[model samples]
Target: MEEKMIVLVAFDGSKAANEALSLAVKHAEAFKGKVVLVRSLKGGADIDSEDIQTAEQDLAYAEQFCRERSVPFETHLLVRGCSPGEDIVRFAEECRADEIIMGVRRRSRVSKMVFGSNARHVILEAHCPVVTVK
Candidate 1:
């Protein structure tokens, strides 16, 4: 049996994240791979009710998006007191994903220094190759 390729997409409901999802679907279709959509619920706050509901809604949207494209996909919500970047990388590793797709925003150097960059962290820490869409 041939090993299947998995594409991991980090989604946060942003336009750039939508683009990343689209690109992941395209890759999945082209490579006959599966897509994994992940959303990180940052911080250790007892998994806020609103956040859980929002994640459910977002995952539903992601599922529909994959269904429309006829792509095989699964969704994961990470709320284990980890940063989004850490969650993304850890999920990718756990899934043995062949590639990771993420949305990146243009941040000024000062802002990046002050706030840190999740995309940057993922890019640096992920085991597989990362594709970033702005």
Candidate 2:
């Protein structure tokens, strides 16, 4: 049997992220594969109970969306002390992901430089194809 296509999606409880998830589902369905939703957080003092709770809620929302579509899915919350991009790339490498999907916002170069765009990092660093949703 052919190896199942693994579509890795970066989820962050945002509208753009939801759009990315929708695109991911379409890709997974086309390939007869599964969707892996990932959310990353810089742990320790960077995260709090409310943040964790919000993340879980986000994952749950995505899970329900996948289930309703009858799409095979799994979710991951990475609490590693790293940027979301790094966490996502590492997880993709570990899972042998076929593609990585993420949401991006329109921002000035200065804004990106100040905030450090995760989509930009993932696009540059991921071993597989990277898809961006705005």
The residue pairs that clash in candidate 2, if any, are none
TM-score of 1: 0.95
Residues 99-131, model 1: lDDT tens digits? 999999897999999999999999999999999
Q: What's the true lDDT of residue 123 in model 2?
A: 90
lDDT, each prediction: 0.92, 0.94
Q: How do all models score by TM-score?
A: 0.95, 0.96
Model 2, position 134, has a per-residue lDDT of 88
Which window of ten consecutive residues has the lowest lDDT sum in model 1?
A: 42-51
